[model samples]
Target: MKEEFQNYIDYHKNKGGTGKLFKFELVEYKPGFLKLKGFFNSETLNPVGTVQGGQINSMLDDVTSLLLIYESKGTIYPNSTNLHSIHHRPLFEGEVIVTAEIIKKGKTIATIRGEAFSKDGKLAATLIHTALIMKSE
Candidate 1:
């Protein structure tokens, strides 16, 4: 990861609201792509002892949004328009590894794909996220 990207993640993990709360860790990065590792702890579990669907969606949203921000070099911010998701299996309290890659980036809209895998490396979920690209202030 570039120092700037690391700095961005560090800043968020330290101070940026839900990013700080979720504690997402960057595992790998490159232009338009990123890998993040997140822990789905006991606090996130639902009644069935599996991580809640909303938590997984939040992580995927962060992954895709952060990738777009990184690729745009902070010049553009992506406002989510849609998130189409599929869950293959329930995720328990453990590490969830997620990867986000840019599928298409237009002047006004961007599309990104994200996948989450359980600690055992089984596919847990997938999301196709679409966002409207907006200029940063």
Candidate 2:
């Protein structure tokens, strides 16, 4: 299922540098929950020997958005609400695992909670995001 989804996204969605350049693996997925792991290279690192927060946040956002897109079939999608991210620690240049779960889903919006961990399973960051489901005419 994930391979098919990734193939579809890769062929259909015009993902920018992060999506194309980085290596992301689908760790797990179910009816309303999804987990992904993103590998971070030197290009994703900050000056302090740690991966940039933006990169981690972006990975969480991307995975959560993917979950939303997979759920909402026939609709235009947008991030209509803010994503609140909390950085717990720094993830160095290595393998980072992130997981997202759908907390709630509404007609026009959905809420997802996600978390990121370092290679050693250390908590790195967390995020709560609101995704907007759109209708296209």
**Model 1, residue 107: C-alpha shift (Å):** 0.4
- Residues 7-94 of candidate 1 have per-residue lDDT tens digits of 7777667766667656777799978789988777787889989999988888888889889888877788889999999999999987
Clashing residue pairs, backbone N/CA/C < 3 A, model 1:
none
Clashes found in each candidate (C-alpha, N, C closer than 3 A) = 0, 0
Error of 2 at 72 (Å): 2.7
Rate residue 56 of model 2 by lDDT. Answer: 86
Candidate 1's C-alpha runs over 4 A off are: none
Candidate number of the best lDDT:
1
lDDT of 2 by residue, 44-129 (tens): 88888788889888888877777777666525564648889999988888778888888998888888988998889988899998
